[model samples]
Target: MSNQKDHHYIPQFLLRQWTGEDGRLVRFYKPHATKLMAEWVYPSQVGFEKHLYSTRNPSRRGRNWLENDFLQRVDSMAARSHAKMVQSPVVGLSDAEMSAWSIFVRTLFHRSPSGFKSTQFHSIRIWEETVREIGPRYAQMKGPDDPETIDEYIREGINGAAYDQVLEHFPDTMMSSRVGQFLNNLHHAYLR
Candidate 1:
């Protein structure tokens, strides 16, 4: 017997996309809901936390971890993001919010126990090196800590790091995982 309440965060359609190569849902799925899940997911209709597994499941410990470290960070970033947007025409949220949310989601995906960790940031490091080889002093300038610098570069058409160039020069660093493919595809999507 399974419970639907554990997985109320992720939309069913989005959840369906995470199926394994064996054509079955990954083992991470569950149905537990957090009280604040609605507050976190609010105004958007459904209360969902896409990358989180189950807040109530003891095996996952999602509620404890999120309430402790993850959501705290997102909330802090959201405040800063909201502050920056007050002056910009970027609408909804300025890049601060967008970047913060992106990082939070990406981090959650990285921390996820069963599925989202399938393709992590470390798994795509080769692509960054390959990108450096193609050109763009930004990679060297930003150094090791700031990965979002690449996103900043893409968002800025002023630099030589254009979308077409990234696609054309993307490396073939396949390590027997679709993670390689996802990184390449992510570049394409990230640019847009």
Candidate 2:
């Protein structure tokens, strides 16, 4: 559950499940709401941290071990949040807040020497742009005139089937490069 108490901050799409797929979940909501979620979470920082840890070259059993463990935990948390976003969409942040997060993440990635992690920025950015273009109604059913329960908004977007829509709508080289960098451990970020 989100801590946002203001009703005005909650988007209607977060009230229900939208789409689904096997192995992965799908959530739908208005484009604006999706944009908010995509940019608002600051997913890029996770990538930046990952890149930093990978470059550290930790000793067999030294502080590097602890650092690596911490980075893994952060990565896990980021992955969980992304999965939840697809499994259960919740909109409680305003567009401005989300944009600020994106900007911050972008700045962090840009400045980090381990900019390899910033590769994920393209995927998040594309998702945010798509959400802005899709419109809320196009993604999920409209919520009630007055939302008493925020859970409903979260529930409405969790669809297990619409996962393909993401790939269909947001196929980008940057996403591929990020994935490649994660798998190969080398940074060739010319796509950005």
Candidate 3:
């Protein structure tokens, strides 16, 4: 999937979502220290969904603005608007998810030796120790002569479970409000 250039949205959206807060997304790729670096650690060429979502119709009925050629131009404009409006945008993670996602993103950015927890939860350690514990496993799993790639190596040892488990330790109310809004949006968008 990674090599297939056509499947752009999944990675692009995930990467973008990592950075954007609420309605705003980033236009330029900045370093990790910037809070605008939210969901993604890398700069990505904007994908078609972002392009489609930003397009508008010419007021002629029955025309699919989503499929229009002019959309690309609009996409650039939207990207710029997104960048300008969201300069230093902050997407606060729930306290539960906060530490976990921070470490997850940091591990991705640093490319430090670490693996995701798959079987059962491990003790939460300071970032440095966490990397140390994970270093050996990462070394074992990472094959000789394998090229280092964040997407390939860090993909495992991580799943919804890792996020969910850490998140479970947090009081439900901490995220219930956000989850409720997400569910409501999902319902309206898909089930309506």
Candidate 4:
């Protein structure tokens, strides 16, 4: 139900750093098979896809929950960290700032179209393997209304619904957990 439609995988604050005096950055892309195109466009105009992070499920909190709730917070924190790093790359960041920047970098990767595709491919592969391995064990626990066999359960009940759930939520979960691990294991030292 959220009003936001455009979601930027690359944060505007980061892109703004490269903007020209006219407040637009030069964007280049292939417009067609025979043409390459370039234009001066606002950062907001180039980096977003409409409803890229939107969820279709009515039971969820909001359609734009990922964009409005999670990404905005990450971008806000990273904006501060980015400013500090811009001012002084080596010495400006505190431990918290470093952590924020790390999270932002990792998030930027996972949120981009290419990264999302890659993650989706891997996640689906993993999920399919997991379901194949565990689906039979859980078949005995099925209620009267459920599919009679594990194979039937997988095909008739689990495939579409579970795949959608995994596709919708797994990237966020993976990003969060990986960021936590990255922060926990990170060590900083100055070498002369």
Candidate 5:
């Protein structure tokens, strides 16, 4: 596993575009959970959370796989495409460049702190609904050794390995499907 802990929801490359002559971007935030205020800070310092993208389950790719293996690649590709878009016209972009930009934009909507929380919420809701539907069947088949009630079954089952697997894999799977749909529906055109 990598020692990298801090993960940026907003890629530094995107944030650095707003940097001033002082090499720092103006960050507006609610300080102390009160009124909003602005502070000049490095992009790296402002848009990250410790271990935000770290997965509890360690795979062959390592614990930081999502951050290192996935988001980093997305950011890198988008950075190249963004540079091209800035220097030239959008209509001049190649298919790959447009695809990269589209993927990045879609990713940004789901990778932010709020977006991640919402994804987690939906995943849990789906799991809960599945458990409720299956609970009666499971209870009927369960032996004396099994958990007594549906709630007990849920608590034990969901707090174990199954829960980790669902939480870890579902969001990535959902994002992949959404990206696939976005790419399939995307059309290319140039306006005069």
Candidate 6:
């Protein structure tokens, strides 16, 4: 999956930026702090889903009309991306896997205008960590020679009872609220 070469809403270079030197996904990618995203991060190249839900700098008043108009279209693509946020775009754990994780979880991490309980937030945080970190950690356990071990570990993390137990800690309200319902619907359509 890592080598599939698919389109990305959040650029892989950017995502790799967030990875810790030890290969964990830290909150920020600190290694290349001075890199400028000007030529690299282009909103026009992103898909509608990413444009709508994941775009970070939507209203910067671009240098030209075309850029500005494109940004507006990106904003109007809100049917997919509605969290008009700048600065920190994606944060923490997410329902999404691989490339989709950061985009899907941005709203949960911020954007809702209301906050979540520490327990609920922790459940969310831990769940994503469990899904993401399990494979690499598993390699450390079983030795790094088995690439299949990563897949097995990920499957275990997803289908395992331990994963289910962590989810059980997530607030029911977090799953039942309006925002939760919206996420559920979105999941059924795109993720499930």
lDDT of 2 by residue, 1-192 (tens): 122111111112222223233222233335774463332222221222322322222244432332233323333343333343454344333333333233323333433433432443454455445544545454354445522333333333222112222223222322344543453443322111
lDDT top scorer = 5
**Model 1 misplaced stretches (Cα beyond 4 Å):** 1-51, 54-63, 89-102, 108-192
> How large is the C-alpha RMSD of every model relative to the true structure?
18.9, 23.0, 18.0, 3.9, 3.8, 18.0
What is candidate 5's lDDT per residue for 109-165, written digit by digit as tens?
777888866876676667777778876588787779878887887677555544455
Per-residue CA lDDT of candidate 4, range 116-157, in tens? 667766776776677678765776787888777777766753
Candidate 2: clashing residue pairs, number:
27
What is the total number of backbone clashes in candidate 5?
0
**Candidate 1 C-alpha error for residue 127, in Å:** 24
Write one digit per residue (lDDT tens) for candidate 1, span 1-192: 123222232333333334556444534323565322212222222434443432333324333344334444554674465454444454454334565545544444434434332432333344455655646666667756545565554344223223223222212221213553343334311211
Better of 1 and 3 by lDDT: 1
Candidate 3: Cα lDDT at 178: 57
Model with the higher TM-score, candidate 3 or 4: 4
- Winner on lDDT between 1 and 6 is 1
Residue 153 in model 4: lDDT: 66
Worst 10 residues of 6 by lDDT: 48-57
TM-score result, candidate 6: 0.21
Predicted structure 6: lDDT:
0.36
* Pairs of residues at least 3 apart in sequence or in different chains that clash in candidate 1: 5-31, 5-32, 6-31, 6-32, 7-31, 7-32, 9-48, 9-49
Better of 3 and 6 by lDDT: 6
* Model 5 / residue 153 / CA error / Å: 4.3
The stretch of ten residues in a row with the least summed lDDT in candidate 1 is 167-176
